[model samples]
Target: MKRFHVHVSVENLDKSVQFYSTLFGQAPSVVKADYAKWMLDDPRINFAISRRGETVGVDHLGLQVDSEEELLDLRSRLEVADIGFRVESQIGCCYARSNKHWTTDPAGVAWETYHTLGSIPTFHAREEKTSTAACCASDSGQAGTFNTRRETTRAKHCC
Candidate 1:
C-alpha cells in the first residue's frame, strides 16, 4: 500500500514533535535531534518534520511507494509526460535512506516521489547534486493552491 506523506519545516523539532504527538495521539516512530516522523497506521500518514528554518508548516508533500519497481514506474511515467525530476540517493534527509524524485506543480510547492531504502541514524539536509529538474520546475507558485481542488475531491471520493 501507498502512504500519505507530508513534510514540514519547523523552528523547534521538540516543540513540533510534542504538538503533533498530542494531536495525533502517539509519539513519533522515528525521532532525531532535527527531525521527527510518525508513521501513523490509523490515519496512514507518513508525517515528518525537518528543522531547517523558522517556518512552522509544510516543506513538501508526497507519496511513498512500497517498492523500487513502483518508483521506477513513476519515473517512467513522468518521463513520458515530459516532466523533469531531481533524483537523490541515500543522503540523510527526512530521517531515512530514500531514493527521491522531486517535482513541482503549477504552484511552487514541491512534490516528492520517494522509496525508502532503509532507516538512517541522523537527520541532515539532503545534498542533491543532480542537474535534472522536475515537472513545472519554473513555476514559483505554492503547491497547495494548485492541488487543493484535486486533493479535496480525492479525500471525498477516494479516501
Candidate 2:
C-alpha cells in the first residue's frame, strides 16, 4: 500500500497544528516541538507541518510506500520516463528513516517516492555537518532546496 505525503512549512507550529487538527477533525498522530504529522487513513495521506523558519506554504509532495517492491516499481517508472532523480538510501528525516527517491514534475514541484523503514527519535540525524547542497539530489521546486529545512534553500539544487 502507499500513502500520499505532503509536507508544508508554516509560520507557527502550534497555530498550524491547531488549524489542521480542526480541519482534519483530529489531532496529529505525531507531534514534535517543531513538527506535527497526521497519518490519516480516511484519505491515506501523510500530511505534515513544521515550523522551521521557512516560508508558509506547500513545501513538497510525495508518495509513501510500504515495501521495497513498491518503491522499486516507482523507481522503474521514473527510469522509464528518463526523468533524472536523486535517490537517498536510508535517509533520516521527518521523524523516520526511508529509502526515498526525488524527482521534479513538469512544473518544478518535487515528488518524493519512498518506503518508510522505521521511526527515529530525531527529525533528521546530523552527521559530520554536511552542506545543505549535499542532502537531496534535485528538484527545483518553488524555492529550490527541496524543503529539507526552512533555514536552508531546498533539495540540493535540482537535477
> Would you list the C-alpha lDDT of every candidate in the order shown?
0.62, 0.71
Show where candidate 2 strays beyond 4 Å.
127-153, 156-159
Runs of candidate 1 exceeding 4 Å displacement: 125-159
lDDT tens digits, residue span 64-159, model 1: 889988888877876777665556555345446676666666665667777887764544333234411111122222222234433322211100
lDDT per residue (tens digit) for residues 1-159 in model 2: 989998887888999999999999999999998789999998889998876423567777899898999999998987787776667787767778778788677676667888988988865645234333323432322222232332244432211
Candidate 2 backbone collisions, by pair:
139-158, 144-154, 145-153, 145-154, 145-155, 146-154, 146-155
Instruction: Estimate TM-scores for all models.
Output: 0.72, 0.81
Q: Which ten residues in a row have the lowest lDDT in candidate 2?
A: 138-147
Whole-structure CA lDDT of model 2: 0.71
Q: lDDT score, residue 156, model 2?
A: 29
> Could you tell me the lDDT of residue 61 within candidate 1?
82
lDDT of 1: 0.62
